[model samples]
Target: MSITLKLAWKSLLNRKTTALLTILTVAISVILLMGVERIRTQAKSSFANTISGTDLIVGGRSGQVNLLLYSVFRIGNATNNIDWKSFEEFSNHRSVDWAIPISLGDSHRGFRVMGTNHSYFEHYQYGQKQHLSLAKGEEFDGLFETVIGSDVAKSLGYDIGTEIIIAHGISDVGFSRHENTPFKVVGILAPTGTPVDKTVHVSLEAIEAIHVGWESGANLGNEPSKEQLLQMDFQPKQITAMLIGLKSKIQTFALQRQINTYKQEPLSAILPGVALHELWGMMSVAETALLIVSVFVVVAGLMGMLSSLLTSLQERRREMAILRAMGARPRHVFTLLVSEATVLTSIGIICGIGGMYAMLAIAAPIITANYGINIALSGITSHEWMLLGFVQLAGVIIGFFPALRAYRQSLSDGMTIRI
Candidate 1:
């Protein structure tokens, strides 16, 4: 066995340039394959964990997908607003534990602005039921005070006490830029790799405060000063959505039914877990397509290796003939060829794993900061192990092609061949 390995090792070193190139091709393909796998698994986990510990997400009557997108992802506009009365009714219900109302339709330099009570900071949870923690300062206490996410703070270079003027709509050049009631950044939340990292959080009153005196999507009356707006009524009459936490899991369905059938207002209550699963399910097709592409890429890399082995076989015929002259049997030639393939593949897999870790080390933080997906620098998962196993098995299987060809060649043919 050692002799065979030594022969294979020296043989590969004979065509060191080709061997190196083959290994690189395999390494790149492995990196891509493992990267897609990592992103797929981590993305699903990231989505599922975006909001946790909350039982249900309540919003105006709309599709479950719509509510999830607008309320949680801040992706689109709300279909309509839910009356504050309805929020109070369900929030005060016997089975309800906590409710955090959400108000949108405002932006600060292109960042979505969210409005909620202090309960948001207390009750809202993320991955593994982790609560949002302040990285720099405390939650907003005043109407004009705001708590920015990590991305927002870093992107806009905002720190505590940094004043920001919000626009009326989602656009940077919105309907009305509230120049009078500029909000001061009070807190900066640590990066959670979720939508919270991209949001600007303020009190519900602050949402109302900036829009005071606005009518028909424009300021029809004189705008109130920041001080005056703070003192006056800022109580929200309607909200875009709310996150609900039930006292007991048993009553979740009952409460959902009750809210859906509410006569006062049409509303939709969706279990966050169920909705999240459905959301991820909708994206599965794309994920599967990406995975297929990666698999093909790996196949291409293996095919390249096969081509290298076959081409090298043509050039190494004389070498094989010499070995046979030295009493090395055809079986020995076969073993050596197979061992060469195995060694090349083993080295490639090693380099691929090393490349993968290096990539994760460099990209994890960037991905977390931009997309809010905290890809952990973890070890190979079971699925990745399966992928690696497939690669190893394929390599050994591919070895047979070259090994068999060399085994069948007669010593006379190999030695007499001049070309």
Candidate 2:
């Protein structure tokens, strides 16, 4: 190593405690910045790809956000039910190609139960318009048959032929149980990293048949025997929402307008893409706030480095005088100060990146299970590379202030030790 760079290295070693702390500060700041960026991107990806290949989500008259919350995310109670006749009219509309009616209101354990026909397994899509695939068995084909999700199977220890009782309402507890008509787990869907992974699926007939004796949120009248239920045909009286795929992209808006202005009932039809955009729009402010906080943390870390360097200058004045006596120019002293910063920053960046990936590797499964958002340990994107570059550049620029102080000290204190 050159004399100046060698001197810079040994100098940091001399004040190892301060230097180590500064490096740690920088590393922590980097971790927070990278974490925020990763979660933000993954959240958007999960929400956008939650449901796809559907042109519109039709529901009882409600705001787009409300419909999206209950229909797509399964986050809240059912807003309102669309009449079965209304669903039929729209499902058979000239512009519609297929429809998947969603009947939600029951929960098994802590997970939701969704009721739909086989069209759901056939037409429903998620993540790049990928169709839902069965991990085991086949779709529900009978009144007492049901399908489950990967997470449900893993959490509840359910597999093919495992019987599960559906609850009356969405709560995990205190709801009426449909014990008389237990649904057999006939199918299990592969994980999709969406809300579907947390749901149990049953046929629409199953939904109606289970409610045969249910009235006013409680069991009423005599429950029919399983054989009697199987002998009867079931038709859903209402559905919470329906996902529609249009015959052509050009007809999406035309049908949406028609659905919104239906004469029989007030309804809302939302383009999933538009609702997703609006959802993100409402959430952007918080994202920006988090980004701002991350930026400030980085600034505080850099400021801490600057503070450490400035304090070290007082003790190094005599050292600078000796360097001048050894024929070292003022520029050499400046170069030494700046090189120390470059070394500390480069090492901190490396440490920060390594630590971030380690945390992600550990937390990936927990995040996927709880949030249904898959965290991919992919290589750093170009944007992150640029962010790191900016951090390094700022570190280098921070060196100039300390270097300037050292440069002046070397020139004026030449051969004259100051105590």
In terms of TM-score, which candidate is strongest? 1
lDDT of 2 by residue, 232-265 (tens): 9888999999999989999998898999999998
**Candidate 1 Cα deviation (angstroms), residue 202:** 0.7
Query: lDDT score, residue 372, model 2?
Result: 89
| Residue range with the least summed lDDT across 10 consecutive positions in model 1 | 170-179
Question: Over 4 Å off in model 2, which ranges?
Answer: 1-3, 411-418
Clash count for candidate 1 is: 1
Task: Supply the global lDDT for candidate 1.
Answer: 0.90
